[model samples]
Target: MATLYQLHSSMDKLRRSTEQMAQTWRAGDSIILLGATAAFIDWLNAYLEDNDIDRIASIYALADDVAQLGDHTNAKLNLNTKLTAVLSDTEWVTLTQDPQFDKVVTIAL
Candidate 1:
């Protein structure tokens, strides 16, 4: 299980490389890289969801990225939506009980 710092560092590197590639107007390559980035983000999202970290560091990172990208409103909305979902007791319990997610929450917390 990766720490929050490790996940953040990985995301930052990916974003920087993706941005650099996009600046060259290489549409196909940029698209491919962006797709890979999105996949990585989705993996993080699922990991957070399963570990009950959706309301913790993951949302903070996501919101920060959204704000840095000049999408404040969408970022706020996304954070609110994910937090709301995570607040449901049943959902929270289910997530916390998942064996695959146990280590991340323990390490992250």
Candidate 2:
């Protein structure tokens, strides 16, 4: 049987490993994430190759721009500004078709 001290040490190691994996994933450091998921490394490689990094980066950059605009100002506090941010450049029909959007509106209310 394993001693309590041995169990504690194993748990600590697991915690450290999981934390490291999460950090690497959040940082978009694909190399470390791929190493951690050794079995899925091939899938990761193929997925990355098939995906459009430039398009993804531009989308995230736009989201960051919106967030920055909302920050350092009372834009978020203003109902009109919030609506404009959420609806600007978005088709009303498309926005209405999103199922999750109702939940967002409910939460806002």
Runs of candidate 2 with Cα error greater than 4 angstroms are 1-30, 34-36, 53-109
User: Each model's TM-score?
Assistant: 0.24, 0.19
The digit string of per-residue lDDT tens for model 1 on 1-109 reads: 2222212325545544333322332111101111113224554555434433322323222323444444554454454443322223453345445453323221111
Best by lDDT: 1
lDDT of each: 0.33, 0.26
Worst 10 residues of 2 by lDDT: 1-10
Candidate 1 to truth, TM = 0.24
True-vs-predicted CA distance for residue 68, candidate 1, Å: 0.9
